[model samples]
Target chain A: MPVKLYIDAVREALWEEMERDSRVLILGEDVGVRGGVFRVTAGLFERFGEARVIDTPLAESAIVGVAVGASAAGLIPVAEIQFADFILPAVNQIISEAAKLRYRSNNDWHCPLVVRAPYGGGVHGALYHSQCLEALFTHVPGLKVVAPATPHDAKGMLKAAIRDPDPVLFFEHKKLYRSVRGEVPEGDYTVPLGQAQTVREGEDVTVITYGMGVHWALAAADQVAAEGIRVHILDLRSLRPLDEQAVVAAARRTGKVLIVHEDHKFCGFGAELAALICEQALFDLDAPIQRLAGPEVPAMPFCPPLERAYLLNADRVAEAMRRLARF
Target chain B: MMEQARHRRPEAQWRGSGGEVHEFHEVHPGEPPRHRALGLDDAQAVEMYRYMLLARLLDERMWLLNRAGKIPFVVSCQGQEAAQAGAGLALDRQHDYLLPYYRDLCLVLLWGHTPRDELLAAFAKAADPNSGGRQMPCHFSDRKLRIFSGSSPVGTQIPHAVGFALAAKMRGEASVSFVSFGEGTSNQGDFHEALNFAGVHKLPVVFFCENNKYAISVPEHKQLACANVADRAAGYGFEGVTVDGTDALAVYQVVKRAVDKARHGGGPTLVEAKVYRLVPHSSDDDDRSYRPREEVEEARRGDPLVRMRAYLTEVGLWDEAAEVDLRQRIASELDEATAFAEQAPYPPEESLYWYVYGEEETSHAG
Candidate 1:
């Protein structure tokens, strides 16, 4: 076992998969030479050479579009979108092309593409740089959306996405790239998609969250523990084809649920979680399902205080947890 | 006299003075006929004519079916048959990949799509191999034939074709990826991005543009700022050639050279085949609202089907009896295909949920 940073874990998965499979290749902006903006793809270019580690032009649509095409031609293409906010130019390729390739072609063709994009806010990256786009892709039926919080899940789930037979959107929270470090297995391993992991067990309240929110929830749960509030934390690693059993069971465990995410409160991934709990475990709930999320502003503001206020930190999560527990 | 009658029409009003009719014999007089010099035998030339006629006949039948309420839609290949058939015949059908737009009825047919398959898709039946009644008609795709499936969004297939080319290059195969669209599609971001990528990678791709003067209602003048769609290829670092699309032999010569060049590692070529749209855009469209009736009549006068037949006749490869027999054969084929498709059952409702994701877990080859 090795303790690895979240970004390094992701890089290990790519390196292992590329070594294991010759057909697996990476193409995106700055993925080669410069080793990606976040250095998640560092050292892969020199090891895999230029062909396997392609450095494409600064075109997001072409990045995703070429991946869609390459996947159909028996190549596993991992396309990087530079940033999640820049992925808007490629929405047609993802939603209309990659997501619908299998269904629209009646299984004659399938696009096995992995679109890796760094997402979420809190590093003073305002407007364009910081945005959560998982909710946009989760709405698409044929696309699998995954946001792994820890190094272990990041490594395992990335391997699974590379090997997936369908298209997947892998969202990596930039704030956790270096800040988060956890034990990861040394060799080949895969965490099956569409499953949730209950990292902590408790009884008073259940906090359903994912990505950076998971880390915040864990810290908040620890803070609330001294106040005699046992907070349960369920990290939804896979957003689409969500682990419904885990979500319902977690809600039923404490009869109190709080959905948290970095995305907007309206029509966010949290809304879907709240709705699922209400539908499946309504009778088991003691208090109304609560959601602690970013405000409905256009985006995270640039000002330091406003940015801090816009984000869901441990204090915010702990306050929400205490309120739900008391309720 | 027939050549004068066919070649006398102005190359399209939008083309201005640059759209001169280029005669193959004028370049190499006393050489063999156009198709012979282009490496086509007399029979192959006549076969090309047959495919062009088949496309025209099938398209006419579809229009009738639409007008009679037998089918719901008709996106025609009425005037672009020569370009489609010629480019299709020039490709290595066994190895090459064809990503065709909706108007490529003849191209798909030449690539092994049967008349029944076309009608089945037109009827959106369960046996429609293209999509199993999921997509609209003329969205051609056949796995066995190596034809990539296309969507309604224009120019998306450009990148897909380039991807196929990239695959062929990486796999060390001598396969070329051929894709076709109208001139309007050249303006799409996918088109520019795809071509730019292919140019950078030097991928083996052939971008065939059927410049039929109109994209639905938008004419060539409105669709492009440049003189020819091929001219845009210079920006992407490839050879671009504009040919008379109505001349099947000329189109064959250009596309054959382009396809051969790509297969031999010469990179991509942008070919603009200047044809015309003889009919309105689609069944839902009424051309009279935008285009005048006289222009449609003038375009019909320079129809590719008629030009191909006359060329075959000039070469002594066709006669009145052959023409009559071919029409009879096509009519019967159309009748049988129409009846079969009309009686075919729609896909079962449950199949709607199927194929959203691959049913089987395909193991990754390690």
Candidate 2:
């Protein structure tokens, strides 16, 4: 088994897709010559040529709008927005145009597009670059949101999103792009969208999380197992059509549920999962749903101490697990 | 008879006053004969007139529905009929695409969309094809006709249109895309960005601005200091043309030439149709607050529909009796469409999950 990083998996997936289909293209600021600020699209311009791997102007709105038109014209465009925080400028394209094209046209016209960006905190990217806007997109009806936690899932999910017929907002965790590694197959493969992957299985309690939080949930599961309490860790690969069935069944079997994410608690993805549990599996719950998420901090500070306090890590996940065990 | 045949020749003939007749031909330099290549004829003109009138009638019906509280929102496309219907007739509906704004019901109707779809969308009915009753009235969209969905937000569709046109270029198809917006859209940043990309890539897209004098209540004079919206195209390094929007023939001629240029790989063009706003921007807006009664009253003389009716009469293709019959036929067609739409069932609430993606991708557990 080879240890391939999530960033490498992303690059590999893009290369394979571009090679596989002439309709597939890549575009963003600094993505071509500089190989992307984070190297997610590195070496693609050299391999695919300038036409396929376009180095666009520093305008997020243009990047998204161009991709929207290209997709409508029968091209499979994958646009990189550089940072999730900067995606606000093009949020109109995502929420209004890309998300609603198929629904508005009654499936007559489809915008088969993907907007990929590096997101989440850690490595001290400061306030502007380290925010999670998945919940904002997940609330939108026409968008399918994907947040992969590992290298294998990253590559598989990217392939699936590229092949998807509607618009997909693929959120790549900047912290996990290089830190997380696993063995990925040699050929092209795709993990189905909106399907949650069960990373580790246990019986006592269920820890539902995604992206960076998936790693922390697994760590908490290990720490709790040593303390005589078992936990099931579920990583949600896609957010929009959430794996509500898996979430409810896990809560019913384990009798306790802990939802974790790096986003703030207010109107976060965790809140949606909790509501789904309350709506479907309320009687099966042993206690109220607990969420281990980033504190309600307006901005992520550059200092290590403040940043640590603002984000959810393994220690916080362990604390959440202990609380669930007590319940 | 020999003299009559010689006089009918298309070449210029010297007159007794030493002036040339300047026989009617293609106006541009290095251009070939227009009638032989374009194959345009009287039938196309008749179609354009019918579509333009249909658009106007549908817009009038929408306003009535709004006043009666049957529809939540309405954006009328009055007085801009020539620009909308002329451009619609010039493009290939099956191949060419339209990235329209909210006030594009006329354009969409000209591209083969039924009046029932407009009414259903206006009423936000369950069977509303535009947005499944989720979006407001006048936001037109139809996939079969290649009409892109319109949004309430300004200038977003400009870039989308460029991308679609670029895609067509990439596929080696000769299709061109046309995007329509009001003069107010020129102020938005997306408008500049879309134009810049379209110019740089030489994408086959036409950036059309229906300069309807006022953006909501703000007059064009206050919006900018430029001479006309077409003049702005020079900055983007493309050909810009302005035509009298009230004259359907003039708008048709200019847009048809531009559309031909784009399809032939000549690059993008900016066309500004100078028309008057005959109705308030939307049902919610009250133009009386900002626009003077005298201005509105005076602008009525240059109405596109009335001017087109005059043209039809001049061509001997229409008269008062024929106009009455045409209106009755259009009204009857609209009535049939309305009855069909009202009888149609509302969309099932359970289907709120379908079509978010393709059918093969809809099996998400959550």
Candidate 3:
């Protein structure tokens, strides 16, 4: 085991997979000599050379399009969008081209491609940079959306995404890139897609969240535990093709649930989670499903103080947890 | 009989005179340019003419079926048949990958789709292997023939074709990917991106733009400001050639050279075939709203089929008897295809929800 930053965990997974399979290649803007805007692909370009670690043009549609094509031609490509907000230009390629390649061809062809983008707020990123778009892709069929909440999950899920025989949208929380540190396994490993990680156990209430929400919920759970209220935290690592069984079981375990997410409160991912819980385990629950997410503003502001206020954190999660426990 | 003939319009009335056919060189119809010579024998030349003719015939039949409510839609290759026949025949179908646009009826046929395959797709029958009756007609695709499934979204296939070429280059294979699109598609961001990627990587690909002068009633001048679609290829760091698409031999010669260059790792080349939209864009479109009647008449006079037929007759590979035999053969094949596709069963009810995700058994060990 080795302690690694979350971004480093992703980089290590990319490095390990490229070493393991020559067919797995990397492509995106500034991914080669510049080592990516966030340096997630640092040094892999020199190690693998240009063919495997390609520096592509400033065209998101083409990057995804080429990935779809190359995947069909027997190459597993991991394409990156510098920021998740910039992925709108490529939604056509992502939704129409890559996702439907397998289905439209009637099993004749498929796109085993991974699109990695750093998403979320809390770093003073303004309207352009700090936005969560997972819910948009989550609605699409034939596409798998994953948001890893830990270094271990980051390394494991990315490797799994590359190996899966479909297109995957891996949304890496930018705030947790360097802030989160944990022990990551040394050798080849994978956390299967469409699975959930129940990070903490409790008897009173279950805090369901993902990405940065996982960390915030854990801290909220700890503070609440000291006050005599035991809280359970479930990290939904994969959003699309969600772990419904785990979600229902978690809802059944606590009988009271609070869904926390940094995404917008209106029609956010929490909406879907809430719907699933209500649909699956409504009888098991003693209370109505509670959702604590960002206010329905357009996006996060740039000022550090305001950005923190706009984003969800442990303090907000604690308030929500106390309310749920009291209820 | 003479009284019936007298009552007919002067243009329609039969005249007693010596009707003589002229040499191809003598008939300078519709300003056909000097055709570049190809390494094709007389028989091969006849085959080229036949491909263009068959494409036209199939296109006509599709429109008939569509109008009769037997088929849903048709994206015709009527006026661009020369470009389709010549460029498609130029590729090495045995090894090359083809990414044909929706209007490429003849090009897909060169890649080995039978008349029945087209009809079955038009009928959206259960036996239609292109998409298992899922996709619409004219969206040609078949893995067995190396034809990647085409999309209704124009210019999307350009990148996929480039990907195929990249795969060939990495595998150390001599295979080339040939992709086609309408001139209007050149304005798409995907077009620029695909060519840019191919140029940067020096992929073994050839981009063919079937410049049919109109994209469903939007004229080319309004779509692109450049002098020609081929002119835009220079931005992608490749050679560009604008050939007279009416001359099947010239189109064949130009595309043949491009295929050879791509196979030799010379990077991609853009070929713009300046053809006319012989009919409305599709069975659903009405060109009279935008395209002038005089312009349509001019294009009909320079029809690729008429030009190619003249070339075949001049080369002495065709005659009235041969023409009659060829028509009869083509008509019989189409008749058989029509009967088969018409009677083909609809897909099973459960199949409507199939293929949205793969059926591969996932490994639970991960």
Candidate 4:
């Protein structure tokens, strides 16, 4: 097993899948000769040739729209929206068109497409580039929103998304792309979608999180370990088809519940998780559900201190957990 | 009698882009660049006339139904029938795909949607083949027929159609996808993006712009600075041409050439059919507020159905008795379709959840 960065894991999956299936092609702005601005597709253009690794003009809506159409027509396209914020222009095509194709046409037509975007704050990407859009897409019925926090999950979830029979929106945390590294198994493997991972197991508090929040919760758990408090961090890798079993089990095992995420506090994914916990394991609760998430700001500002204050960090998670434990 | 004979060819002062003064004989006032020839024989010409007549009759009936509080809505295809039918009929039906907009009743009809299919959609009936009564009227779709179900958002279908072309090109197939929209829709960013992608990739697709003049009360002059929508294709580095939309044969000829070019891998083409809205934009709209009533009356003077009927009569392809028989036959068919749709059952109450996600996976979390 070789240690790989989160972005490298994503690239490996794309490269391996394209090599495995001739129908699989990559299309996005600067994805070909430029190998993507982030270089996640660094050598794919040279390896697969121009047609398979297409460098599209700067058009987000067309990129997704073409993928929807092409996917229906028999080709599997993995379209990349340069950043998460840029995907707004293509929401109509993804939500209104591709997502509805299967149901609207009564399964006569379907678009098996994947859209990958680098999301989250702390990269100093500021307002436009550091937004989390998983909640918005997760609300859509047909779409499957994937947010992988580890190198292993990144590779496995991306491969699974590519081979999925429906359209998938894969969000790769930009800060985790280079910062996080882990040992990835050398053979073919796929982490099943809609399953949660108990990254850390303990009994004092149940900290449910995903993406960068998982890493923060781990740090927070270590900090709280000194105080004799054990935190069980459950990484909800797949947001859309959330594992209700894991969410309920975590809530029941450790009644002290804390939900953490980088998305907004108002109507964020945490609210949904909180709702699920209430519905499935409300009587099991020892105290109220404590949510540690980004404030209801428009976006993360460009200033470093402001950006740090705007984002949810491990210290914040630890401090919130201490208060929940006290409660 | 001599003046009336010449009335068949309306003469107008035409200004070329090169600043040349010329006189052209038009079958209608806005008859595009060429209208002198058609490839259809006597019977085929008569069939084309019949389709236009049927489309017009269907449009009129839908309006009546809407007014009678029967159908929920009516998006008129009154002025663009000739262009839609012509371009639609010219395609290789067995292979090509269709992505028609809301104002494409005639195109969808020519693509094999029966009058009952349109009526069922209007009534939002259970057996409606397009969407199982899920979609609104005019959002035409037929999976078996390779028609993409379009949405209310304008220009979104352009890229989807290009995807069809992209698939064909990648597979090395000769199939092409035909997508239609109004002139105002061409102003959208997706339209530009789709055209640019198709042009760059050299995909097999036809972008047909039916310039019906008004996009919900906004005129052509207000929509774009370019002379015509087809001109935008040249900027995308593909072949583009504008033809007389009212002249069915001419539109057919131009679109046929473009389709051939695309199928053979020559690349995409943009076609603008300069059409008029003979009626209000929709049953709910009142054109009186925006433009003068005389403009609507003037457009009706060169109605495509009337012009096509005249052309057929001139070539000895149609007669008054044939017209009377065709009208009677279409009238009876319309009656049958309307009565059937009016009495059709609405979708079952539980059926609302159907098709919201994959049919196999019914357990969806809110």
Q: What share of the true interface contacts does each candidate keep?
A: 0.75, 0.79, 0.68, 0.79
Number of the candidate with higher DockQ, 3 or 4: 4
Estimate the TM-score of every prediction: 0.95, 0.87, 0.94, 0.93
**In DockQ terms, which candidate is top?**
1
Candidate 4 per-residue lDDT, tens place, B246-291, comes to: 8787788888888999999898989988889888888889989999
Compose the digit string of candidate 1's lDDT tens values, residues B85-113. Answer: 88988998999999999999999888998
Rank by DockQ (best first): 1, 4, 3, 2
lDDT of 4 by residue, A240-293 (tens): 888999999988888999999999978999999999999988899999998888
lDDT of each: 0.89, 0.81, 0.85, 0.86
Give residue A198's lDDT in candidate 2 (0 to 100). Answer: 84
Question: So what's the TM-score on candidate 3?
Answer: 0.94
Candidate 2 lDDT, A243-323, residue by residue in tens: 888888778878799999999899999999999999999998888899888778786998999888788888779888988
* Deviation from native of the Cα of residue B91 in model 1, angstroms: 0.6
Better of 1 and 2 by lDDT: 1
Chain A TM-score values, per prediction: 0.99, 0.98, 0.98, 0.99
Go through the candidates in order and give the C-alpha RMSD of each one to the true structure.
4.0, 6.7, 6.6, 5.3
lDDT over C-alpha atoms for residue B104 of model 1: 95
User: What is the two-chain DockQ of model 4?
Assistant: 0.70
- Is candidate 2 or 4 superior in DockQ? 4
Clashes of 3: 0
